[model samples]
Target: MLLSGQSHAATESRLFLDGKELSLPEKVEIENLDGNVMIPIRVVVENLGFKVTWNQKSQSVKIEQRDKVVQLVVNDLMATVDGKQESLNAAPLLRKGSVVVPIRFVSEQMGMEVDWNNVDKVVSLITPVIEPTIKEPVKVPPTTGSGTSSPTTAPVVEPSVMLSQVNTIQFSENQLKISLSASVQPKISRLTGPDRIVLDLPNTMFSDSFRASQGLDNKLNGRLEVSGYPDVSGVRYSLFSSSPSTVRVVIDLNSAKKYTLLTETTDSTLITVQLREEDSVNIDPIVPNVPAVNDGRKKVVIDAGHGGSDPGATSISKKMEKDFTLAVALKVEQLLLQEPAIELIMTRNSDVYPTLQDRVDLANNMNADVFVSIHADSFSPTANGSQTFYYQRTNSKAFANVIHKYLIKATGFKDRGVTENGFFVIKKTKMPAVLLEVGFLSNSDNEALLFTEELQNKVAQGIVNGIKEYLGIK
Candidate 1:
């Protein structure tokens, strides 16, 4: 099961040790009355945006809100909800003094929903409505190609994305004006075998026939340049587009140097190559241009934007964008985690809101192939549904297309249309990055559905599938 929770409540079954309904602790692990499975309640409740608590002295579990309290007794089959006699199908049992209940009945009664697969013996809980949840974003180190499947279920979650169709690249003019972020930097490496230079571009351009052009010999002379550059032997190039704002171009070089890069209007990527005299450069002119070899997978960075402090784009539902985004992000994470090759990373895993700059910084630092910032948009609840935004740049065109199609198919938000905006995260990111407005928080009708895990996962899965198509990975 890609998304599994502890034993969730099914029929409003609350545990009452006596006539007093007990409160459950926040983020505590509770076992079933049968004592078969221990469920981690933190992940579940966090997604649900509920307060959980445990009393060490009393050895009891309590979940309290502003007015209501749900209490459970250790090893006791009885529970109390707001101090009332409530019948329990399964009583709260004690484990080493702490009370635990079945995840099925409890999660449900506590204003959450659960899905059960009898055939597979799996239980998943969806928080009814996500409120304010704080989270932080951290960067993970690097890895190679050879992508594995995404763990949208129980097994895998990767930090990569794929590119599929190139929908459209709209330019205000025939030649679009695009700029790179100062924080956006590239890696320069030398390959051993072929005398070639490699360029790692953050994104692949949008064109029916678009690929990096590499040459070993100085083709400027048009002498059918073999590997004959005296200063540099050859060059290899590749571009992977995860978002409109991202692409990675790896230029294989004959020798290594401290290079400064600049892209000019003539479409020539100038690499002021300064190599050490320590190595002799070899060039090969006869070799044909090579295609970039992907690990055959893409990295997915599911950003639960606006955690801890900054809650971006709030709605009238009193539902913080931070919480809604986290809930959806979790769903996306769970769904992608099942895939073996698809590595998953959350820009914000908890309620803490991460800064826009830090969010982009993580993606860049991690060297993520693709970055998707999940956000629940808000306006007048009357103005509901979802729409995605990308930077107004030509480089991000391909990345935007792949994600655009998939989001429409998955979320089914009002096709607000893909437009250009100068969002801080996407523009500043060094990699292919896109900001997704899952749905309008201002829209009341859409918010109801937005709170569900099923819908959230479906949307998440759609994004994953879209990435897969872009990368040409099954």
Candidate 2:
């Protein structure tokens, strides 16, 4: 039996081997360090058909798995894999007398597979089992959405509902509202390949003028098609399935964003979706906006704050704010790549921490049009909100105001509004800069939402939207 730590063992996560739960002697210390999952060495290595030996003299652990030989020392950042020295993103450490190593490092070295379920907090390992055990796959409901489904369970199907048409798609203060004609509430699911939101209307068909009606023109397949609004790229409807008579409404997104499904109680026909568009660019009334002058391409620097030794905020789920920030920043970086007119620069892409001065120097040296520092806030567990900070002397207040407005709307979190702060990165940068606190990690609900893949993408899009608006990108 392995020894477990005494700190908050009740909420410890579990480990699985080939779909079968392992009875671990100690609570697993599954942590995200440098964006990689770290777990106890004995629990993972021994379970994977490997033999582990502890060397008390050198304070190192040795493992022999098949032909692979690995050595890791406690509190050391270097490991020996088959006599080759390698650097670890996170050092091996002794957690309550038990040694823990990076999960990816050990798994890759041993030729084993590893997977993590953020929602269930389960770490799964896949190894060659002589007697393979078969486990039933978790049942997921039917999804009728046309694009990819977001990382959420399928909504219950209401087979009796009927849809007539999508009446209007409107854009308002940081929201894209879609109104539809329906007899009953529709089931909604979201997906992320090319960024799409899907609506499944049971027992419904398109209206006669659903295709003919046009309010906004968008270029699709070299043809001018009505997109209903500027924020959404295109909308398509299809009979996904005949047996269930499901009509799927697919919203082709121009950028990463979030949505809320609402059905009018008094008028079931009026189904409205509150969408946060990351591509939408608007003039900020709060500050004087300077339009992009050169080549119409805006240069942006995205800084993910805190890394390495800096844990930032610890969430109720035990996720570090640094990990969340980097994850979100990477997602934003991915979405921004789609814009041919935008030049993107990152402060730090990996787990290594970048000094505040280094971040500012990178932005200034690049002559970046704007600099954004992404961070997650920490406060009392009851405090839940998103706020943006700007250096008081610069025009960052305008950038902060614009981005903060869209960010809070996209997150659907309480708005703490834009405030002034002389943070090192924001104050030292010559260009317009803003520091974004996405949400308070201490809040349970906020932490849970932040951990989801969908919300992370949405938050990235919100930051992109702010940049687009500030730069006057079309």
Question: Largest TM-score belongs to which candidate?
Answer: 2
> What digit string (tens of lDDT, one per residue) describes model 2 on residues 169-198?
433212233445545346664544346665
Cα RMSD to the true fold for all candidates: 27.6, 22.1
lDDT by candidate, in order shown: 0.49, 0.66
| Model 1 stretches astray by more than 4 angstroms | 1-297
User: Per-residue CA lDDT of candidate 1, range 87-183, in tens?
Assistant: 5666556544345456654543453233333333344443222111112333423322211111111221123422222111111100111222221
lDDT of 2: 0.66
Which run of 10 residues does model 2 get worst, by summed lDDT?
219-228
Query: Against the true structure, what is each candidate's TM-score?
Result: 0.38, 0.39
With a 3 Å backbone cut-off (N, CA, C), the pairs that clash in candidate 2 are: 148-191, 149-190, 149-191, 150-190, 150-191
Q: Give the TM-score of candidate 1.
A: 0.38
